[model samples]
Each structure stands twice: as structure tokens, then as C-alpha cells.
Target: MEDSGMRIGEVAERTGLSVRTLRHYDEVGVVSPSGYTPGGFRLYSGDDIERIMLIRRMKPLEFTLEEMRGFLDAVDHPDTPGARKTIALIRAEAATRLEKLRRRVGYAEEFLRLVEDL
Candidate 1:
């Protein structure tokens, strides 16, 4: 797991994700902490934080939890044939989404400029 000793609160603060959101991600099995204190506090690793960040990035892409899980699994097992296929599809979809977001942002900037001129 290469787990870090960082607690859940630290992880939430560092990742800009709420504590409840981190807990929910744990509950949903999207990203579970790699360790726990004897007092029952959740502890996260660096890898766990990276995984959470990946999930956060995917949120703007409107990926469902299942899709996030699949993507994570694919990342974890890139050598698998199915994982490779999933990665290919997700990569293409992400590029398309990025292009769309760029276009939308351009429109938004244009609107803001017009509004500012008034």
C-alpha cells in the first residue's frame, strides 16, 4: 500500500475535499484509507491522496462512481487486456470532454467581457 501516516483530516485539508466527502468515498469503496490508528481514525497514504485527486479530476467529467472505480482498477492493472481497453476508451472520452470544456470556457469569457463593457 506504501501508506503514509497522514490522518483523514490532514488528507481532506490537503486535497480540498471535505471530511464528509472523503468518508463518503471510503463508504462507496472509491478510495479507502490505507491505514488506521488504534483509536479508529483513518490514515491515508500518498498513493491514496493521488487516487482521490484523480477522482476529483474525474468529477468535472461527470463520471459515475462505477466508472471511477473501473478507471482506478484499470490504472492499477494496466497489463490486463480489459484494463487496457478501458483505459483507451477513457482516455479518448477525457480528451473529448476537455475540448468541450475549453469551448464552454471561451463562451463564458466572451460573455463576461461583454458584461464588463456595460
Candidate 2:
């Protein structure tokens, strides 16, 4: 309930991610909360919320948790030489995923047409 941070439930409501998903992300080292309450409740800062939003954007493109973590690390340390390469790799992967999604949408449209004809 601090002014600078919010509890997990509030973050979940704001981010449209479930509390369980947030906990799992923490457990897996994807996007951990900034701090914890005296009672051990996770408290997330605005930076943490923004990090979670970035991860959410990657999820729909089918990025694995590890991949998401790598992208976040690259974003945080952009001055590192390897960070540029990592980001390029992520962009390539996203492009590939976009192509696959387009193909799937085409198949779904064909399926809808078949259903309409039946």
C-alpha cells in the first residue's frame, strides 16, 4: 500500500496478468518484483510494471520465458556489445513469428469459409 509500489494483486489488475503468472515469472527470474512487504508480499515499482508490460508484449509473439528474460537483459544493458546482437536476434525471431501468425490467419479464414459453405 505504499505510494511508490503496489502489491501483486494490484499489479495483476493493472497489467491484465494473473497473480499466479506474476509469481511464476518471479520464480523463473523473468520479471521479479522490486521489493517485498514485511509480511513477504511482493511489491512492484513502476519500473517493474513497465518490465512486465514489455514481457506481456513478447508473450503473444510466442517468446519463451528465457527468451523474454534475455531481451529484458539486453534492454537494460544496451551499452554492452552483445546486447545489440541479442536485440537483433530477438527482432529476427519476432519477424518469423509474425510470418507464422499470418499463415495461421489464412488457414483460419479458409476454415471459416468451409464452415460457411456447410
Candidate 3:
């Protein structure tokens, strides 16, 4: 809607996120408007877009909404400590998902074999 400050649609287009998802992020306190438009529309800034992009990519990494909030919080609040805590959180969940996927893939493979026999 506005080039000076990208509106929600432009942000969605640029970030490959749906407007609905952006609103959900707002409600979830994941990301919010830097300010409003002359017509009272939400206007996002470059910083907001960057954060949303990071969140977008992190989703498939299996980071929960709350964990994402934490990551954002950590980003906001820098730390000199080792990455053990962050690694533990992401890795444990990813491993869990990996195991679940292995089971699902195994089932699909068996199903394919049965289909071939039929």
C-alpha cells in the first residue's frame, strides 16, 4: 500500500507469508506493526520483515510458537553464553520429529510394496 513503509500485503508478498499468518503473529506477539498508515492500516518496516522471514524458516525446523518467542527474545537480548541451550532445544525436538518421520516413511514404504503386489 505504501512504499515508504511496506503494508501488510507487501510484507506478505516479500516474505511469502499470508496476511492471515501475519495477523496471527501479531496476536501471538511474534511480530507487530512498526506503525499504522494514513488510512489506519498496519504498516510493517524492514526490521519486521526480517524477523518474520527468520520465523518463517524456523517453522519447518519444528520450533514451536513459544520457542520462537524465546528465540526472538534471545535475539533481542544478546548472550555471550554457549549455544548449548539453544541447540538442546532445537535438536531434541528435531530428533523427535525425525523419529516420527522415520516411522511414517516406513509405513509408506510398506504400503507401496503392498500396492505393487496388488
Candidate 4:
């Protein structure tokens, strides 16, 4: 397996992702493994690990799977002008998500205050 690639379980452990979640990502064409072993186990390379990390970062920003794929595609073709546009879009979306999270935190604090008053 050393010459081939890391197994899915190993990748999950290293990436802190559940096996089911990794499988789902593969199923959804979000982060397919680099290859498969003779026994049909998925093999992930360092590049795949980096890609999964990117997806993980994007998840908190609420990027859909399709959007994640688009981002990954842009990353793969960094020379394209569209890559710059995609990154700008992702940054804008992240700002929006951050604002929503701030609002939710404020609402949670208000709820806590109401409970304390009671």
C-alpha cells in the first residue's frame, strides 16, 4: 500500500472525517480517491488529502458540494482567469456566512439572557 497510496480508513483518520462521510464525498464526486487497490480499496494521495482539507474549510462557509467541486476545479486550473473569479465568489460567500453566524451568536446570547432573567 505504500507504493500505491493511503487507504480510505487511514485518510479518514488523518483528515478527521468519518468513513461514511468520505464515502459520500466520493459518491457525490466531490473528492474521489486517486486510485484503488487490487482489493478495491480506495487510495488517496497527498494531493487528495490537501483537497479534502480545502473542502473541510469550505464546509463551514456553507459551500454546496457542487460549489466545492467548482472551487476544486478552479484550483486545479489556477492559470485560468475564471479561477480568480471563483476565489472572489468564495470570499464573498464566506463574508455572508460569517455575518449570519454572528447574528446567530447574538440570538443565542439573547436567549441565554432571557433564561437567566427567568
Candidate 5:
């Protein structure tokens, strides 16, 4: 079934994805609209909405644009196994980032304590 062909604003609101992000996605060949309005506004279908949501969730996990491109490209395969590999990679990367953040937080706390001693 075809969707109502949502405008860019609607897509941004619905997916919690900024319009700029959507445009960037389009520019990077990540998630593109199925059609366009007369004014060249991107029009998104239901599938595009799902893809946008997936990209939104993945971004916060600290997935770089290059990593995202690789994962998105893997989806074009005839099989669905790439999802598992993608998830595994995200988990590992997120864990590493979390540890780095924890170290930064500890350093910040120490700095605060030292400042209070003055």
C-alpha cells in the first residue's frame, strides 16, 4: 500500500529527525524520498519513514556517517543477516564510547573537587 506521500516537515516531525538530517541522508544516499513535490520538496513513503526511524535510532549509538553508509548499503543485499552484524558492531562501539565518557566524567569530578579546595 502506498502512503500519503508525506512532505519533509511531516517526515521530520513523525520521525523526530531534523529536516537537515533528512536532507543529509538524501545527499549521502542513505534514505531518499520515493517522490518529490512540484517544488522539489522530498516526499516520503511509508517505507522511507521506517528507514528514517532506523537511522535516527542508530545515530545516537555514535555510528559515524561512514559506518551508517556501510550498514545501509548492507541492507540492499538479498538476505537480512546484515542486521545482526550491524547490531553487534553498534553494541561494541557504544560500549567503547560509554567507557570513554565515564573517564571524562571522572576527570570532570576531580577537577570540580580541586577547584573547590581554593
Candidate 6:
């Protein structure tokens, strides 16, 4: 194992994702580890961890795996006009979803208050 890279287990712990989930991400080619140990263990660098964190954020916003790949590609090439357009579209979609989520949470809170009143 390289001293500069963290093992998959460490990445999972830090990212709050299961080893299985990380493996799935790797298998899907959404996020590949930066290095591998002599024993064939996966090792992730700081940039890999940052990318995983971005994936974690997107999951809650209901971004699909394919969408993730596209978004990451755009992130990697932010200087391109096409990438800029992709980012704009995704950001708009995310905003809409977050607004819907907030409304649902408001409803849930109201229900909880009514139940407490009883």
C-alpha cells in the first residue's frame, strides 16, 4: 500500500459509504480509486475522497448513476461551453428537487405538531 493513499475501508469510513457501495461505484466506472496496493487492495487519494463526497451529496438529490457520471465529467472539464451548459441544467434540476423536499418536510412537521396537540 502506498503511504500517500488511503485504503478503501478508510475511504468508506470517511465518506460514510459502505465498502459494497464503494465497490459498486468502482464497478460502474463512476468513481475509480487512485491507486491499488501490492496485495490488490484499492487505495483512494484526497481527490477521490472529494469526488465520493460529491456523489454522496447528489444521491440525496436523487441523481441517477448515469447522471452522476455526466456531472463528474462536466466537473472535470469546467472550462468547456458544453460542460457549463450541463452544469446549469443539473443545478436547476437539483434546485427544483430541493424545493419539493422542503415542502414535504414542512408537511411532516405540521403532521407532527397536530399529533402532539392530541
User: Tens-digit lDDT track for model 1 on 40-95?
Assistant: 78989888999999999998888899999999999998998799999989999999
TM-score result, candidate 6: 0.91
Better of 2 and 4 by lDDT: 2
Off by over 4 Å in 1: 1-4
lDDT of each: 0.91, 0.93, 0.82, 0.89, 0.81, 0.93
Clashes found in each candidate (C-alpha, N, C closer than 3 A): 1, 0, 0, 0, 0, 0
Ranking of models by TM-score: 1, 6, 2, 4, 3, 5
Rate residue 60 of model 4 by lDDT.
69
After superposition, the stretches of candidate 3 with alpha carbons farther than 4 Å from their true spots are 1-3, 80-84, 91-118
- Over the stretch 1-118, how does candidate 5's per-residue lDDT look in tens digits? 2334999999999988789989999998888999987777788998889888887877656678878776776665626767768756766887887788778889999999999998
Minimum summed lDDT over a 10-residue window in model 5 is located at: 72-81
Q: Score candidate 2 by TM-score against the native.
A: 0.88
What is model 3's C-alpha RMSD?
3.8
Q: RMSD of model 5, in Å? A: 4.0
Q: What is the lDDT for 16 in model 2?
A: 99
Candidate 2, pairs of clashing residues = none
Clashing pairs in 4: none
- For model 6, how does the per-residue alpha-carbon lDDT over 1-118 read when each residue is reduced to its tens digit? 3746998888989999999999999999999998888888998998999999999999988999999999999999999779998999999999999998899999999999999999
Model 2: CA > 4 A from native: 1-3
Candidate 3 positional error at 71, Å: 0.8
Q: What is residue 5's positional error in candidate 1, in angstroms?
A: 1.3
* C-alpha TM-score for every candidate: 0.92, 0.88, 0.68, 0.82, 0.66, 0.91
